[model samples]
Target: MGFTTPTPIQEQAIPIILSKSDLIGCAQTGTGKTAAFLLPLLHLLTEANAGTEEENPKIKALVLVPTRELAGQIDQAMEGFSYFTPVSNLAIYGGGDGAGFEREKMALTRGSDVVVATPGKMLQHLRMGYVDFSQLQFLILDEADRMLDMGFVEDIRQIISHCPKERQTLFFSATMPPKIRELAKEILVEPEEINIAISKPSEKITQAAFSVPTGLKVELIKYLLSVKSVPNCIIFCSTKKSTKDLERELNSLDIKATAMHSDLEQVDREKALLQFKSGEYTVLVATDIMARGIDIKGVALVINFEVPRDAEDYVHRIGRTARADSRGVAFTLVAPDEQRDLFKIESLIEMEIQKVAIPPEIGDSPPFDEGNRRRGGGGRGGSRGRGHNGRGGGNRGGGGGRGGRSGSGRGRKPAGNRR
Candidate 1:
């Protein structure tokens, strides 16, 4: 990890965290926010243990991420940075085997220097009465906005209550919405606040949109990919069914593609991301779960199959490309009905996205009719991707509860999760 030059967030945040000051740093994803907090946290932990003879690996830092994928990501990053040092870490998340839970229990109860976890699963462990956080020194909430959207606010409050009151709390988010500020106010006392690259897409991203009929989306994707020399792409779909359907159809057209959504088991989900990262697939069809912190490099393009519900999410979806100062393109397929979403996005970013006409190959399309356009439920409904991990009878509906199993990320109903 020869990260010599730090991004803006890292430059400003690292020192503040090192000083043990509570902080709330706001920045978009892919802006080195992880290292901004982690590097200092690691340094503090390392310095604190410099002369200690006791080596029980007590958890000194707790990072609560919004998604299981992000939890795994932070755990991997910790290992990378602490490779030459004695920094033991564990990533606790839902949707794993019983053995996995046992391992998490062992690490949480026994010891680990750092613990990265998802909010819901972390609450589950805390409820079990085995884990100890009375000595927690640093608490981090990554992707705080997403957690709030997933109905994890109450769970987060509960988890925070269990920790020592006198602790350094750091909350990092892509966008600093009012709700996020509200939470920060409640939790952080005299926190040094910093906002970098707020509510804006990177300048390197070439943004454009296609206003087409919903029916023509698949055809447009087929024609565009066939015509353009796309090295790699991510097609963001609105639904898990559509993700799977598009992947299957793209494969039928002989394009190496895969669908990644809640329908996939934890194993398969990991495998899909691995295959994509390893260059086994040129395209990854997914939902907004991939929109945030699941890093995959050399992504030349991001195609929104349908407009996202939230304006800020559009920024995140496009942020996947145009990362690390490399130029890339973001194309959104906006249905006539989704004009409102597109308008919101343009308004949020304070720039009009270039409107591109669909190719003639994908012929006549539906015209935008305001009255006929149905209001799209674009954002997370209920527990977002907290579907049960069960393959069958034991299906834990997302958010960890007993319910009829539906093979989708935002699967069928199960009132709510324990968290």
Candidate 2:
């Protein structure tokens, strides 16, 4: 909370939110988008609850997010910001036991001042008819684009049907795609739009890539870690299997690493995140689940073990590093078949990433020709393709469509980057 200066998004958004106007905020990850909405909303809520004599205060603000991790993170932020105030908040999300569910029910029925929840869990409570949104004043959707990409449109619509129609609605997303725009139109009314460097990686990040064969990705990653001596790093994989496999390989090299994915229980995921943040784990191998809304400070590096199918995801993956204006490094290992994906990423970020040569001991690397690879096929290019199929591409089948968010080869750049 040592925020002396406002980020561009915060400066533009806080005013509009305080004015009680619906707003569409488009800002890249690592910006202060969360604070932009929360600070003003906390002010308004504290004012409204100053002298109320009611036993059960009505829920004033509800924040809907894509994942439970995000819900918990926002809830923590809300608690920190409103510590000296009388405003109370609760985070309701899935993967809890009966006691946790009961606690959430009590808070919802008796009205917490602010509530942050994932769409599915909130919808489950709403269906039970014990939850009430009669006096809900502010409705905020953080990571709106991610919610849509996760196929939460119907759940969102159902949840909105319960809230009052005359509330100030805020839609915040890192990328404002056409579908996000369509959803905004349906919910937001004449909202003031604010965009701040959408889809651009932080200038503090030194971005580079190594064109390596699919078989030697682990070797390349180990080599980089040893040479760079990165104290804190997050390695992003496109699938859970890849995440676990990479974690194992890194551990085999005596590197301390942990894996985070949807398959882990909620407690384990939280523990992994906590350990990573607390320096217990020097490296966190994860799927795209860690790409957005999970903010950790002092991360020295971020590595893309494989290129994300969605180009915008590349921005969020590398965004884990270089946060809070600190300089960091981002390295991506691109195989021959994944060259096209890397090209799309470069096109979206509007700058070609430097291609670093792999060390001679790691053997021959793939040619950095996305065009030629596209003309031929997406095959692994030679006999070195042995381990490629096991890890699978970006859109492999997995729990709850985690891999399916890879948009069907449509090169849609993130919105609001005209400059």
Report the number of the highest-lDDT candidate: 2
lDDT of 1 at 306: 86
Residue range 238-357, candidate 2, lDDT tens digits: 999999999998999999999999999888999999999888889999999999988998989899999988888998999988889689999999888888888777767667799987
- Local distance difference test values of all predictions, in order: 0.76, 0.79
Q: In model 1, where do residues sit more than 4 Å from their true spots?
A: 53-55, 365-419
Q: In model 2, which runs have C-alpha deviations exceeding 4 angstroms? A: 373-419
Best by TM-score: 2
* lDDT (Cα, 0-100) at 368 in candidate 1: 44
Poorest lDDT segment (10 consecutive residues) of candidate 1 = 410-419
For each of the candidates, the C-alpha root-mean-square deviation to the true structure, in angstroms, is 11.7, 11.9
